[model samples]
Target chain A: MLSETDISAISVTIKLALLSTAILIAIGTPLAWWLSQTKFKFKVVFEAIIALPLILPPTVLGFYLLMTLGSNSPLAGFLEYFGGGSIAFTFSGLVVGSVIYSLPFVVQPLQNSFSAVRIESLEVAATLGASNIDRFFTVAVPLARSGFITAAVLGFAHTVGEFGVVLMIGGNIPGETSVLSIAIYDHVEAMEYSQAHLLAGGLLVASFVMLIFVYLFNRHFSLVRSRDW
Target chain B: MIECQLKINLEGFTLDAKFSVPDQGITVIFGPSGSGKTTLLRAIAGLEKGDSGFLKVGDSIWQTDDNFVPTHKRQIGYVFQDAGLFDHLDVSGNLNYVKKRKTGLKKVFIDSIYTLLDIESLLNRRIGQLSGGEKQRVAIARALLTNPKILLLDEPLSALDLKRKNEILPYLDSLHNQLEIPILYVTHSQDETSRLADHIMLIEDGKIIGNGPINEMLTSFEMPLSHSGDAISIFEARVISRDTDFNLMHLEFNGGQFIVPDNALPIDSLVRIRVAARDVSITKKKQSDTSILNIFPAVVEEIVPEGNAQVIVRLTLNGVVLLACLTRKSSASLKLDKGSSVFVQVKSVAILN
Candidate 1:
């Protein structure tokens, strides 16, 4: 049976994953688009920075983020001007860390799909009287539908599985920063094997079902089935 | 008049063009492939920007020295080689996409353009569902709904097969008859040139080689077109009567009458006939025993040498001038030269719709 702390931890995990996924979509879309379309010389540098979290140790990222969010850091001083006070050990701070950890998972699929879109399609839209912003919405976005689905699934799933970054920044404060992975850690530390097993089992089943749904939807809904002209 | 002057560098070739087109007819930009024909059309439509030039389309200066209008803001419709229809939209939806940008019109041309293009049955069909010819028709209709002052077609038929080309050509002709706006059509086919163009602008090596009415350009001695298989005279004639028993139709031109083989057009219908130069022979005197159907007294204007063994004779029968190819041996035996009066024999002529 699941304990009360396990329920709270599950609720906190869902909140973090949902908020980070939303923020990733809002910010990552334009960044991925620029990466796909730009011909700048420093494009390689931007690409390398986004992909750093993919291979870097999660604890290392957590350590750097910890320094950046501490009260004594320059970034914290800038944030204090807006009354944001030391963001370390806060829920919002955990969201910022999860978003960074899942950045490559969301952006790589999007950039590949955006690059696959033909230039002629955009030129045709322009000739039809659509401006730059209008073409981006009407043409590019609709054509990259599959990419969006893959990116959202991977991003949300990756955030929910994150443990090191969550523990480092938003440390377990029961009902505040104690997510499912952290609760399972506590159950193990306190020698409560059954409680840890219940929470871990729930997360495993939930992630599996979500990933299955995405694969099934993509297979059945091939974007506008091609007609035999 | 549309005055265009542009100079630009592309790849390894340089395009330097200058020409004036009439405001209200089909002006075909003709050339072999890779001759910068489509590039010229692109420059005029603002899809291509050159270093320096002026494009004045009936008083509105689209581009000059420092000022320029982008392609979408200019009042022009463009049709690419492939249909380039929006794959996501049905035929009607594609047309509506452009119609929404129209500022002043109260009524949409949905029914008229679709009907004229013979695409009424395809309004609800997705773009991918249509065949090559059907797609082109929808593309043309979509461009028409935009209500542009000039229509730019860049090798619109080059992507289709011969059978499809023949099927779609009549609608293009009907469109030319109905619409008074100037159409800048690009093509390399001689058949399309002869059938659709009112004026022809020939390009080669990225240079303007010739520009004039189709009839004048087809018969000019200075043009290389007159020496090729495309050498033919276009005469406007109406059928006067048909001898059904003999299988011959009598057609009357401004100068004289011709008895051609029985054809499909009804009597009293005006038609265009293309007479090939090779089918004509010259005789010093009118031969009564000959089986030739057309015989007219013509005065030789000039004789141009074609290689070493043959010469092209420029002859005027009444007021229409056409080319006649004769062997050097025949020319020497008949004593033919400029101002020589002779009877010309025409073996056959093709009837062009």
Candidate 2:
């Protein structure tokens, strides 16, 4: 059985994952659409920047993000300018870290799917009297529905399983910034073997379930695309 | 009238076009593949922004040097070669998608287009299940639902086979006759051009080579269409009488009456008659005891030598000119020259529209 702090950490993890996934979808869709459509010479450079977190070491990313969002940093300065406290060691800081950590998981699927949304379809929509925004929502989004599910699930799972960035930024404050991964880590460090097993087992089960959903969804979507129905 | 001037710098070529097409009939932009036919039509539809251009459809200024109108803002219905329809939508869904955008909806317009295209049974069908011709008909119906001021077609029949092309040609002809909307139809097919175009613009290598009324352009010796071995002259005529005994229809034009295989088009309806140059023969007198049906008096107007063996003879009957592509041996045998009076024998005639 998990303790009070463990249950609270699980709730915090769910909250952080949901909020980060929501915010990522809002920002990532337009960015992904632009990335897919642009043919500029420097587009590859922009793509590499977006994908840096994918290949970079998690600790390395955590170290730099710590400096940028720490108490002494400019973002904290901006917070204080509005009579707010430092963003460091807060739930907001964890959310900011989770969003960055899970960004590639959300954006890559979306960008790939947006690219696959045929330009011909959008042109037809425009010729049929749809504006750019209308086409994005009506035609592009519906056509890329599977990609949305994949992106959202990956974003949520990645945020839920994030370790290094959350550790550096959130610092394991139970009921506030502590998440399931960090709580499990704390249990391991304290030699609380039973507690660690419980939390780890739960996360393992949850992650496996999420992956099953994604793979099945991908298979179904590809079948539809190939008209295997 | 649709007046357009466009300048675009594509990767390997630059398209520079200037032409005014009549607002009442089908104006064909005929050219070979990769000749900027589709590019020029897109520029007119305001889908492709050119380096510089001026486009005016009737009174609306769609484009100028700096100012521009987006495609959705322009009242243009463009039908692509592949019949680009939304796969997620059913046929009725596709039609409603455009119909919902219009501020004004007319039941008359909807009823007429549905009946005209013969797509009433296809409203609930999925787009994925439609055959090529059915999809194109749906696309046209969808476009018409918008009540577009101008209609643009980019080789709408290129993806279909001969059977489908024949099936859809009559509907396109009906559209040209019934709707007063200016249609800028692009095609590489000679059959479609002869059948539907009232005005023809011949494009090659991204340039407008020749453009005029269909009759003048087809007859002009300098035009690209005139140089073909299969060059044809079109006669605007009306159905006067039908012969049940011979199963032939009589069409009356300025020069004389010509008979064709009986057609289903009603009496007194205007039809285009295409006389291929090779189907005509010249003699000094109207010969009898032959299988030829159309024989009329004509004067040799001009004779331009073609290839190494043939001469394209321009003959005038009354005031209407017809072209006869005869070999050099035949021309010399008949002693045909400019101002020479002769009787032309007809072998075959095609009823186009």
Candidate 3:
């Protein structure tokens, strides 16, 4: 028995998580690939930056993102000019925050998986007349599918569970930017324990199920794929 | 012809190799481990860059001072020691991955490779399900599906067990015989070199010590074959007849006839016979009755004492140089010396081709 507001909150949460995960994957794949393959002098610095979110408190990150996306900031002004709206208190701002918050979860696994792909296979693909892009899709991507799956699931689940960053940036706009975690916070704040229980239980079950599915599916695929070699 | 003059420096080793191979037939780079055989193959494939080099395959110049075509542009297919098949791809998917990107589709078809490597049964199976031999076969098929101008086999058989090696050798032989493309086969095994190579390049410590036809190169006394303290001789012969009564095949060469224990060879099939120096006994006179089926007249070309106990005898039989290894005691008792005529009684001969 969920209320209309709770359903709206769930829809917004799903949209934010899905959009953030998609953006993270699209941007993180090549960045992770470069981090995995390149022998540059400052590789450790880049790796540390990608992994910063994992170690830093979410409020600290959210503070920086909120300030950067404020109406007076250059990025916010640019988006305002382009879209005719400020991104600071919108759903888009929450998405941008979540993408940064969950980037390491998406990138680290992808980097590890891309690094684990056999160099010999890439060389073999090169010798077979496959171009650089061709080799990446044909050999590297397929070989690292399990890593991609793990990264996607973790990014999605991690984004769903986010509270501090969303609370700071999204500001609990009921039907637009208020996601499930924020809605749960609002319910508990008003002493509506029953509504809080429903949302909390749903998120708990979802996070557990998503993580279980990721681990089980990754293990099954890795075992089957590695055995063929 | 494929000509390469490369000067590259790796950690603690340098490869300054210059060689040219014919546009057809298998030219095997025979060497020991860490002898730069694979490095040379990689350089030819453009997978490894040299400090300065000139590479020409057929009529296309791949690498020069200014033009360095990357590996993807070169129409070359390389099979690594580990097969390097895409683990996520099934057998057919692995084969088709390259076929789809190949620009020159008129050269070779996918179905031909499926039949050539006998991989039709493995089409739907994943790579993890395949045996080592089956994986190598699929790798070969994947490489062939690209219809490359040249095929580079970088110790493709070295990773397999002896049984797996035996299982995959015939497909390699058929690849050698049926395909017109030139192959640069890298191997450390002399047996594989003898069986698959039409020409041999003996590499040691990053240099070509010997380069010529396989038969002539095997018999060259200046190579490590002489240093091994065993006289080695390679005779080119053809199957003339098979003695079914004795389960032997009669081979005719320029020097003389020999009997080898082998089957599955039809008449007039060209083959190479390897007569180990240690298995040949030199006699001053021909014996009337003996179990040895080969006794040819030979003139002693050279006699070099191998060590404290053995002497290596180089003999010329009908203008072909043959080697024989004997104990110093046997050499002294038989009065072996250069310029002396003798009867070479071969205790055993192995059919290498």
Number of the top candidate by lDDT? 2
In terms of TM-score, which candidate is strongest?
2
lDDT for B287 (candidate 1): 85
Q: What are the TM-scores, per candidate, against the unseen true structure?
A: 0.92, 0.96, 0.93
Interface RMS deviation of candidate 1: 1.6
Residue range B1-353, candidate 2, lDDT tens digits: 88889998888988999988778789999999989999998888777888778999999999999999998888889998899988777889999998889867888879999999999999988776788899999999888888899988889999999998888988997898788898889999988899889899999999999888998999999897888798899978899999999899898999999988897779999888899999999999778988888899999999998899999999999988899999999999999889999999989988876
- Per-residue CA lDDT of candidate 3, range B97-135, in tens? 886876556543767777899998999997778999998
Runs with alpha carbons beyond 4 Å of true place in candidate 2: none
Q: Which pairs clash in model 2? A: none
Per-residue alpha-carbon lDDT of candidate 2 for residues A69-113, written as tens digits (9 for 90 to 100): 888889879988999857778999888888888888888999999
Query: What's the true lDDT of residue B12 in model 2?
Result: 92
In the range A35-140, model 1's lDDT, one tens digit per residue, is 9999999999999999999999899999899999977889999988998787889888899999999999999989998997787677666677777888888888
How would the docking of model 2 be graded? medium
C-alpha lDDT score of every prediction, in listed order: 0.85, 0.89, 0.87
Predicted structure with the largest DockQ when compared to the true one:
3
Q: If both were scored by lDDT, which would come out higher, candidate 1 or candidate 2?
A: 2
State the fnat of candidate 1 relative to the true structure: 0.44
Off by over 4 Å in 3: A77-86, A226-229, B103-109, B242-249, B260-264, B329-338
